[model samples]
Each structure stands twice: as structure tokens, then as C-alpha cells.
Target: MGKLKKIETEIEGVYIIEPTIFGDERGFFFESYNKRDFQEIGILDEFVQDNHSKSRKGVLRGLHFQTEHSQGKLIRVIKGGVLDIAVDLRKDSATFGKSIKVELTEENRRMLYIPKNFAHGFLTITEEAECLYKCNDYYYPEYESGIIWNDSELNIDWELKKYNLKKEDLIFSEKDKRHQSFKEYKKAGGER
Candidate 1:
């Protein structure tokens, strides 16, 4: 039997998956994604896009979501490790504005599943880290939107304090900085 660990939070559809790891003296092995198993477990989304990114410590990449085409993400660390995060941006959801954080490392071999309508981001815990993810929809550049990672309103305990982040090191795009706050977003029906 596979090991299933569910994190029940106020968030609507955030899941942390720790698949069964088979380890011997030689090494360890596990199924990152199995369609049959996923279906059995009710994760039936067909991932149509995949993305990979490499980042150095102190490089923050996001609180991003596509407005027009929401995407569910199945993410894992391939090379190093990171503190992955997802924020429930679905306005209609009871958990809207809530966020979940998880650590994905090479040794842990764990993956996170962020359903559609959630904003996703991560911080590198190691000097260098690689993140790979499967998406339910192709990335729509025009529809992409983001929120400021350090927005006081979200109050995400990014744990960046431990990393000694400087104002300049907290990188963000102009678009991200201009994103509406949680309250403003909800008033406009951010969820679809």
C-alpha cells in the first residue's frame, strides 16, 4: 500500500504528498507520478505542460497565477531543495488568502500539488536549487499575474529573515508589485 498524508487546512485544495519510498542498501526509488494511482487517489487532472527553473538563494520567483487559464501544479525538487509555497487565491473559497508552505528536498523525494486558482511560489533553501513542475494548462504569458512576495497584507512567514534578505535581494517584477491586495482581489471576484 502507498503512504498517503493529507494536510487538512482551511485551504480548499492544497495537498502535500509523500509517496512510499523504497530504499535498500543500494539506493531509493519511488513513483513521482502514476496515472492509475493518481486516478485511484482522485487526482485525475491531465498535466499538459511542464516547467523547470533553477534559482540561487535569495532569488524569489513568485506569487503567480494565470487569470484566464488557471493551472494546477505538481511540483518537486530535482537537484537541491526549496521551501515551496501556494496561496489560495480562489475568492469563492473559504480558505481564500490562506497559504501553505512545504519543504522539498532531494533526500525527501516529496512533491506538492497545487490545484487551479492558487498562486504558487518558492524560495531556495540551498545555495542552488532546481524546481520542476507539471501544469494542467499551458502557460499564458498575457494572462499571468502575480502578487508581491513581501506584501504586508499576506503576511507570509517566508522565513526569509533567517536567510538575511536585503531589500534588493527580494526580487520582483513591476507586474508583481502592482498586483491587487487580497482584499481588493476578492472584491473583484478573483476566483473563477
Candidate 2:
């Protein structure tokens, strides 16, 4: 198992990392992240918070980020799989208003690094999915906020066309529904 590839995007501080996997009759193993290797690849974040979530299929978790104490995240799935998404919300970024989506699964051993000032979300693709992430800052409830996952302005192709998503299955908090869209959020100086 070795470092397979690093995909740097137009969005600053965003990356997709694919690690080499070695399998045998027993099982498979891979190095998820090595601090030295991360530094070499220019991912110099020192994560201080770790979060894990489990969700059933059709469960959608966000378009969430912090307005005050924003977090940069290194996200991946440990079991099953999900369609992970990151939307650029940084008002000053070149990629502002753009979004990137990727599939993450145990088999792929891939991870996404999302820098601060972006909204993060995922949709469970398997019967069940276990997602984990390392965050550069501790979560602050007061500062936590989100945009509607289906917001038209951002125009994220969640690729949910194949999945049978029910109204109940597309779960969200009341707050998420009311959160500002990119255009509105930007006009209100939502960027940090």
C-alpha cells in the first residue's frame, strides 16, 4: 500500500486523495494518511476534531458549515459508501459557488480534504454508511449553519436521480431549509 494519487482542484485547499491498496487472501490494508506524506503533498492541516456518523440509505446530511468558527475537514467513509459533496462558499475564492462531488467507499480508500469556508454534505449510497472526518476546529453550535441541499442556485447535481428518495428520506432540519442560498448569503457578507 502506498500513496496512489493526489487530485488538487481549482478550489484552494481542496483535494482528493487515493491511496494504494494491498489485498491478499486475508484482507486488505492501506495507509489512510501519513502526516509527513500529507506535508509533502501540501496538506498541512493539523486536525483537532474528529466526527463520525452513521446513516441509512437515502439519508442526506447537509450542505453545512460554520459561519464563525469554520472547520476544514478531511472526510472519508470507513464502511459502505456515500456520495460526498463540497460546495465552495468562500466569497473571495476563485471557485466560489462551485461544487465538487465524489464517491467514497471502503474499497476505494479515498478521502476528501475540504478547507474552511465550504459547505460539506453526503448522501448514503449503501444500505448503511459510516462516515468519519477530522476537523481543524471544534464544532460550535451557535455558528453552525447550512443551505438547502436542493437549492437551485448552487445547482449541485447530487445524482439522486437514480435513487428513490422520498420526502421523508430527504431529511433536513428546519434551520437548513431557511438558511440562505449562495447568492443571498454572499450579499449578506456571509463569508469569513
Give per-model TM-scores: 0.87, 0.91
Query: Mind giving the per-residue lDDT tens digits that candidate 2 earns over 1-192?
Result: 366478987677789988778889999888777777778788888989889999888888888999998899999899999999999987787888899998999777799999888999988888888989999899999888787788788888877766666556666557766776777677768842
Model 1, residue 109: displacement in angstroms? 1.4
Kindly report which residue pairs in candidate 1 clash with one another: none
* Candidate 1 backbone overlaps, count: 0
lDDT per residue as tens, model 1, 29-72? 78788777777667889999989999887767788888889999
Clashes per candidate, residues 3 or more apart or on different chains: 0, 0
lDDT of 1: 0.80
Residue 141, model 1, lDDT = 86
lDDT of each: 0.80, 0.83
